[model samples]
Target: MGNIKKKKMIFLIMLFIAIFMIILAIISPLLISHDPLVTDFENVLQKPCSEYPFGTDQVGRCIYSRVIYGARVSLGTTFLLLSIVFISGLIIGTIAGMSGGIIDTIIMRIADAVLSFPDIVFAIAIVGILGPGMKNTLLALSVIWWTKYARLTRVLVMAVKDKEYIHAATMIGASNIKIITHYIFPNIISPLIVQLALDIGGMMLALAGLSFLGLGVQPPTPEWGNMLNEGRSYIQTAPWLLIYPGAAIFIVVAVFNTLGDSVRNLLDPKHI
Candidate 1:
């Protein structure tokens, strides 16, 4: 009982942090005191002070404001990217799993081919071919990200398709779409939810890494990754420049990961 209570408390704390970050991302621009992109050459590389809580970067832009605004880019991208991946994967996997035979084989093979390469490498190649930009980066990440969801959904659907409920639904002349939506989807959703929770952190990290590599958001965009990249040059002179954005990434990732783990534990049948 004590253990369960402790777990619940942890889950609530993580959940609060995650929700706070999302809300912060949405309202970041309004919260900033200075223009994130405006430069003041005289204030360049200023240490943290009353006027600039996070100090100024080499270009004299407000690091505090940039970091706040960056929440929108980083978190917003993760949300949008995952939404597409989840929906596309669900549709494709549902179709492949329900249809099976040649269709299943073909889809699975394509997924396997994509998965065979390391995700970062494939993302880099796609970004390189498509050229650097937010849209291109999203397209690149989405192309590879959906494969995992598709594979997981396919496996889950296959496992449960032969169950009595599915068989009964089919016998009742329910269409494939009806059967999948009404019967199969509900049973598989818990695991998918858990996967979504976990993948949010990974997607953030991947997007940040891409930005760090100069293939994402781009310069002066106020994105955490781009901020980190920009701040790298000043590591010796102004460590706070790097520290603030890096800490933002680390905290957001950690909270989401903890939330995901807590969700998994809560949803696990064995625990219940």
Candidate 2:
């Protein structure tokens, strides 16, 4: 009972933080007091003050505004990447799991080939080929990230396809599509949701890392990663430049990760 209460408390706290971040991301534009990109070279590297709550960067861009706007970019890209990966993985994994033999072999082999490469390395290669930009970065990430979801979904589908209800559905002449969608899909959702939550956090970190390395969101954009990259040189002179955006990334990622773990614990029968 004590453990359960602790878990519940943790869950509520993490959930609240996650929701707050989402809301912040959604309404950041209205909250921003200055133009994130507009620079005031004369007032460069100003310390935190009422005019610029988070201070100013090397080029005098408002760190607070940029950090706020950066939330949108970071969350937006993460959502887009997640959506593409989830849908493609679901479809491919479902098909491969349902259709055994050559189809399954082919699909799994392709997934394996992609998975063989280190994720960051593969993403960098793709981004390098496509040229560095937000769109290309997302595309690169989506291409590499889908393999995990596909493999997880495939494994889950395979494990559940032979269940009694699935057999019953097959015996009743249910269409393959209907069986997979209505029967198999629903059963696998718990684990998928857990994976989705965890992956969102992971993707946030990946996107930030990419941006920090100058392979993701280009200059003048108010992305946390790009902001971090720009702030690196001014770390000693303008620590706030690094702190605000770095803290933002850290908080968002930690929130998702904590929430994901809570959800996984709650959903796992072994934990119960």
Candidate 3:
């Protein structure tokens, strides 16, 4: 009983943090101390101090402002990616799962093919072909990442489709839509939610990586990954530029990963 309470408490705390992060991302522009894009020639590479909390970068942009606004690029863009992939994957997976046989086989095979390549490698190829931008990055990743959700959705659908409740529903003449909504969706949604939570950090890294490689959110724009890339040259002279942004990614990623675990454990019957 005590453990259950503890688990709930932890989950709530993590949930709050996750929400706070998202909210911060939403209102980031207002929260920034200086224009993240505006460079100050005089203040370039200033260390953490009264005026610039996280310091100024090589171009004299506020490291603090960039880091704060970076939440939008990191978390905000990721949220968009998550939604796009989730809906598309859910639809594709549900169709394949319900259809089964040839459709399922073909879909699974395609997914397997996509999964075969190293993720970042494939993403690079796609973005390369698409000519590199936020839209291309999102499109490339959406095409790549949706496969996991689709496959997971299909598996979940197949597992529950044969259950006793489903059989009972069929015997009682429940409409297919009714059965899906009343029974199938409820059972499957929990896992999907957990998967989404776990995906936040990974998706952020991928976005940042693309930016780091000069393929993503292009320069003068304050993205964490790109910031790191820009700061790499100045690593010896100025470390805060890299350290602060890197820490932001690490902290946000850790928070979401913990949130994912919290959701899973809280949802587990054993834990309850």
Candidate 4:
């Protein structure tokens, strides 16, 4: 009970932080101390003050504003990536799992081959081949990330395929498409939702890691990953730059993870 309550509290806190980050992203222009592009040669490396709560970056861009805007990119990428993965995974996994025999073997094997490579390696290789840009990052992320959903969906669909409703639907002369869509799809949705929440957090971290390495968001984009990359040189002299962006990544990831855990618990039949 204590652990459950703790998870709930953590999830709530994370939700609030995520919501605040979204709000900050939307109002960043008005809230930032100065234009994110404007450089004050004299104000370089100034510590956080009443005027600059998060201080200024090496280039004099407001750290607070950059962090806020970074949230926009990270969160936006998470949503886009998750949507593409979920939809594609659901369709592919469902078809492959329900079909069985040669089709199932072929699809699962192909998915396994894709999943064999390390996710970051696959992302970097794809992004490098596609060249640098946000679009490349999206392409990189989406290409490799879908396998998890596909594999999970396949298993869930297979397990539910033999259930009474699915069998009844098949016996009642329902077409394969109708049975899969109407009966099988609905039962697996809860698990899929939980997986999505967890995947979002994982993807956010991957995006940030890619950005920090220059394969994700490019410089001057005010993205959290880019900000961290820019701040690396100043780690010794100015740690706030790293701290602020890092915190933004940490908080958002934590929120998604917490939310995922809570949903998983709620959905578990034994727990309920």
Candidate 5:
């Protein structure tokens, strides 16, 4: 009982943090300093003070501004990535599961083949091929991320399709598309939600990783990962540079993971 209560408290804290991060992301543009890209050589490497709460970067760009803007980038990419992956996954997974037999085997095997690749490596290859910048990142994420969703949803669809209601729908001469859209998807929505929520954290981490590797958000763009990358060289002289951005990434990912877990538990109470 004590453990349960503690877990609940932790979950709530995480949920609050997630909400806070989201709010920060939404209001980033208004909250940040004038033009995150604008450099002030005089203020370079300034410590946290009344004027710049988070301090200034090595190049005199406001840390506070960059972080707020980076929150926007992080959250925006998460949403866009999930949207693309979710729709593609649902369609492919639904078709594969509902069709079954050779079709199922073929689709699942393809997904398995894709999944066999190390995620970061696969993303890097795709991004490298597509060249750098936001479009390439999105393209890379969409290409690789869909496989997990497809696999999970395919399995889920298979399980849900076997249930009595699905059988009843089939017996009533419902078309495969209708049966799937009306039955399988609704039943599996909970898991999909959980998957999406969890994937947000992973996606954010991936985005940051890509930026750190010089393949994601370009410099002067005020992205969290890029900011961290800029800070790496200055770690010996200005540890705060790395600390703030790194902390942002960690906290946001932790929040998403916690929220995902809470939602999963709530949706599947039997598991809890």
Candidate 6:
């Protein structure tokens, strides 16, 4: 249908954007024309010009350079966070679902307790208690986030555990580990891929929010959220400070969300 074609086209465009962003992030240091951390008070708050495509910030740091460098921090942190959450969740969920009984009850209960609270609020509390820093924020978010993966993985495993194919594998003397890695993972990976794509944007926003609140990557680090926090004061005089970084976040998040939607549609059984 026309609708599906349009959707696929949008997905391809967004996918290109996403890949470009990642490439930029990887080569940010080489791409930056100015030293992101170094300040040039002489040219402070200069508007966009031939020398500075995105202009200078309040402290005369190159906004373009900072934004580019910030991409590294934001994307790296999101990828690390996702890896931690996904692996921990997958392992715990697999154990619970495979073992069942009291182990499942205890793990589910713990996850339930964590999930009951608003995620941002809980993250704030944890970071506040541990003192505001990037490491603490990463640790807190990782601890909270793994539960979502665990729950999903547990359900997926349970759904496939009793399948006739799985039973046949068991009867043929295949090891539990082998069955899981070879059979279970392949069957459930489509949903996991969809979840990963969906979470990428959310994790990015979560890190940005924490930084905006002064609890994430500290200032002078060239993080987008920290840039936004610094740029907030000059919205009237130097809107470029906010505009550039904000637009970066918006574009990246939109690209990721588009990818997530595309993945979900492709994986959805009804669509197939």
Cα-based TM-score, every candidate: 0.96, 0.96, 0.93, 0.89, 0.91, 0.96
Candidates in order have lDDT scores of 0.92, 0.91, 0.91, 0.83, 0.85, 0.93
Model 6 residue 206 CA deviation in Å: 0.8
Question: Can you write out model 4's per-residue Cα lDDT over 1-272, one digit (the tens) per residue?
Answer: 88778767766777676678778766666776567767887888889998778999887778887787677777887788889889988888987888889998998898888899998998899988999888898888777877888888999999999988888888889999888778888889988988887677888888888989998878788888889999999998999999999998887887778777777776666554
Off by over 4 Å in 3: 168-175, 270-272
Report the error of model 3 at residue 81, Å: 1.2
The best candidate in terms of lDDT: 6
Models ranked on TM-score:
1, 2, 6, 3, 5, 4
Output the lDDT of residue 222, model 1: 92
TM-score of 6: 0.96
Residue pairs in clash, model 2: none
lDDT of 3: 0.91
Model 6: worst 10 consecutive residues (lDDT sum) = 263-272
User: In terms of lDDT, which candidate is stronger, 2 or 4?
Assistant: 2
Task: Tell me the deviation in Å of residue 56 in model 2.
Answer: 0.6
* lDDT (Cα) of model 6: 0.93
Candidate 1, position 270, lDDT: 65
Screening candidate 5 with a backbone cut-off below 3 angstroms (N, C-alpha, C), the clashing residue pairs are: none
> In angstroms, how far off is 102's CA in candidate 4?
2.1
Model 1 C-alpha lDDT per residue in residues 58-147, reported as the tens digit of each score: 989999999999999999999999999999999899878888999999999999999899999999999999999989999998999899
Better of 3 and 6 by lDDT: 6
* Winner of 2 and 5 under TM-score: 2
**Can you write out model 2's per-residue Cα lDDT over 196-269, one digit (the tens) per residue?**
98788899999999999999999898999999999999889899999999999998888899998988777776
**Which regions in candidate 1 have their CA more than 4 angstroms from the true location?**
270-272
